[model samples]
Each structure stands twice: as C-alpha cells, then as structure tokens.
Target: MSNLDSQTAYWDTAATTKTFTHPLHAPWLDDVNRHAAILDYGCGYGRTMEALAQQGFDNLSGVDTSPGMITQARALHPTMRFAVLDTPPTLARPDASILFAVLTCIPSNHAQKRLIAELSRVLKPGGTLYLSDLLIQDDERNRDRYARFAEHHDAYGVFETGDGAVCRHHPSDWFPSLLADFENIDTRRITVATMNGHESAGIQILARRPSQAQVGPVDSFTAGLEDR
Candidate 1:
C-alpha cells in the first residue's frame, strides 16, 4: 500500500478511536522496562510509542510496514526511531518488545511461526516478548463464529480483517508451542468491551528467552513444563 493509504488505515482518527477501546494500554505500559531498548512492533500511529515515552522510556523504536504509518509516527515522535519494515525486521536486538494486537493481522499459521522465530532472533537472552491477540475459544459456538469471521474476511499474508475490523484469530493453545524456543512465563485471556459495545476476547502472552545460565540440560520436570 502507498504511504498515504496506509496512514489512513492505521494512523487516522478512527484507528486511534479503536485502539483506546482496548485494555492493552495500561497493562502493557506497566510491564515494559523504562530503560531497556524496546520495539513497538506494528506500531500504528505511534500511540503506544508515545505512551511508552510518557512512562519515561527513552530507548524506544517503532516499526510498521506501511510507509504512511511510519511517516505519521516519525512526525509525531521525532526523537524516537521509526522505520518501515516490509518483512522480517532487523532493528536493535532489544531487551523487550510490545506486540499488542499485531499477530492477529498475520494471514497464516506459517507466517505466525516465521514472525515468532524472528522475534526470538531479535530479542536478547532472557528478553521478554509481550503479545496480545484475538484467541480461539473452546466453546463450539464461539469457535464456529470465529471461523466464519475468518472465512468472510478472506484473510490470507501480511494483513487480515473482518467486518470492518482487520485481525486474525488464534487459539489459546497456539502460543506455548509457537514460542517453545522461549521460556514460557505466563498466558491469560483478556475480555475487552469495545467502544461500539461489543465484547471481544484475546490472549495475553508473556515469555522470556532462556538466560544463558539456564540453557543447559534441563531436569525432567522443567522439560515437561517447557511443553506446557
């Protein structure tokens, strides 16, 4: 997409309106380190980056595929680094990253896997990855509804959307296996009431890369926990 169109879709007023409706802002802010190098993956309009700055994080950077979005972010946060990323990113190997509502926009499972691998690569040992995205539920009705939404959207590589909302859905069980290369720290579901008065469900996952000291042969129980 051209820079202008991308900005319209991701950095416009509507996008800002949609973002604040979610609960990710406060929690993510609480979790990020103020002094560590941080990346706002899929940072639309740089809102989260701004929020991070407000929290006293100076070593912040943002990456988005849309040049328009990047432009808006750079203009708004002049001191912060903003870059256009078409594929796998190669910015600073950060101590942490905030990936709020980003993975769901990836079109396929393979793409998700690739992105996770890239995240692992870009993070330092013992670094943290915080991710939030729409999640598949065990309820048959919810599962059916989610599947229909995915089908209707024709979501297929870098971008996906449904019913005027762009997103991809993943099961709650997906993260453990997908992030097995990292040490699983925690996982939970969060229910958000959107501004339009609709309730949506998503998963919040926090994981850390194994520290250098913890990389040796694992105990049986620890190894089993790794599978959990």
Candidate 2:
C-alpha cells in the first residue's frame, strides 16, 4: 500500500478505536476572526471543525485523507462540509482568500512542505496558520530510534510504527527555518495527551503570511517636496 493508504488505514482503524483527549488549537483559535474562512487540514472526524462551529465560527470547512473519517465527520457534523482526499488538497477558494488554517496531521517532510505550500496558496496575506506536530525528543531512546529509522527512510527523525505506518518528528529548531516564508509569531513546546493515554512532546507553531504591503521599501518622507 502507498504511504497515504497506510496512513489512512492507520487512522481509520487504530486511531479511531483509541481515546483522544488532546485540546485542538487552544492557543490560537480565539485569535482568529469569527467570520473568516477557515480550513482544518487533516481534520480527523471533524472534531476541531465541530468545536470551531460551537465557538460560533460559521465559515468553517475541513478535509481529510480517509473516507472513513470523512463519513464519520459528516455524521457528527451534518451541517458542515467535509471532503475526502488522499493527495495534497487543492482548495476551491481563490488565492489569498483563506484567513485561518489549523493543520495537525502531516508527518513527512515532503508532505509537510507540500501542504504548507498549498496553505500559503490559499491563505490571504497576513493570514494565520497554526500547526502542531510531534517533536524529536532529546532522550537517548529517541535518538536511538531515529538512528535506526534513518536506515530505512531518507529523512531524519522518522520511525515505523508497529502497524506499518511511518511518522516523522521534527527537531525543535527546525520549524522556524522551514516556515521562513511566513512571519514566525510564536513557537512553544507543549505536552499533548495521546490516544494511548500517553503524554508526548509536541511543538505548536503560529505564523503569519507576510503582507504584500510590507514587501517593498517604504519612503518615510517625500524626497523632492521637502522645502514647501
């Protein structure tokens, strides 16, 4: 099976059956405009979208890679729109139209970059993007696992789960450089409660797309009309 299929299957079967208690986007959700167009990329079972709707966000939409997840999301949220997509999503919205994005699911470097590019394509200049993902732990056990995973995968900090799915973790210092196109607003480490009732180290990032108005040099004063 392709990696996408593996990931879909992993989420549909294993992740679905477990208990998930993590709070989604708690740090940045309130800062978004209530009426702004929001995309919940990789929104599993539409939980975050549903929460956003409860918080009075009317322009919320979501996309997931697994059809099973989408089906469940539709059942749980009858009024909201959700799409099943296995590839990097191409949103119907025009360029610079989206105002907020909550991305929580990409694990590989290529997929992460691809989704970031797509988010950048759809999000308005000065729009906010919130991302949370696993971080490469500093312990020797994690180091050993990363070293072993390097033998099988081309990227760093990757590991194969017992269920045949691969997940990548990023170092703490990596995201600022990776998201250089955006203005880094904040980056912090937070403990997340996982499906298996374990606390894992995670990185939460808040970034804003640079506004077009801020791109060029600005003249502080009129150079030719100084003596008027």
Specify the poorest-scoring 10-residue window by lDDT in model 2.
219-228
Cα lDDT of model 2 by residue, 107-150, tens digit? 45665566566666556667776666667767686688789888
User: Which residue pairs of candidate 2 clash?
Assistant: none
Per lDDT, the best of the predicted structures is 2
C-alpha local distance difference test of each model? 0.56, 0.57
The whole-model C-alpha lDDT of candidate 2 against the native structure comes to 0.57
User: For model 1, what is the error of residue 212's alpha carbon versus the real structure, in angstroms, after optimal superposition?
Assistant: 2.8
Model 2 residue-pair collision total: 0
RMSD of each: 7.8, 10.4
The alpha-carbon lDDT assigned to residue 220 of candidate 2 equals 14
Q: State residue 83's C-alpha deviation in candidate 2, in Å.
A: 1.1
Please report how far candidate 1 places residue 24 from its true position, in Å: 4.2
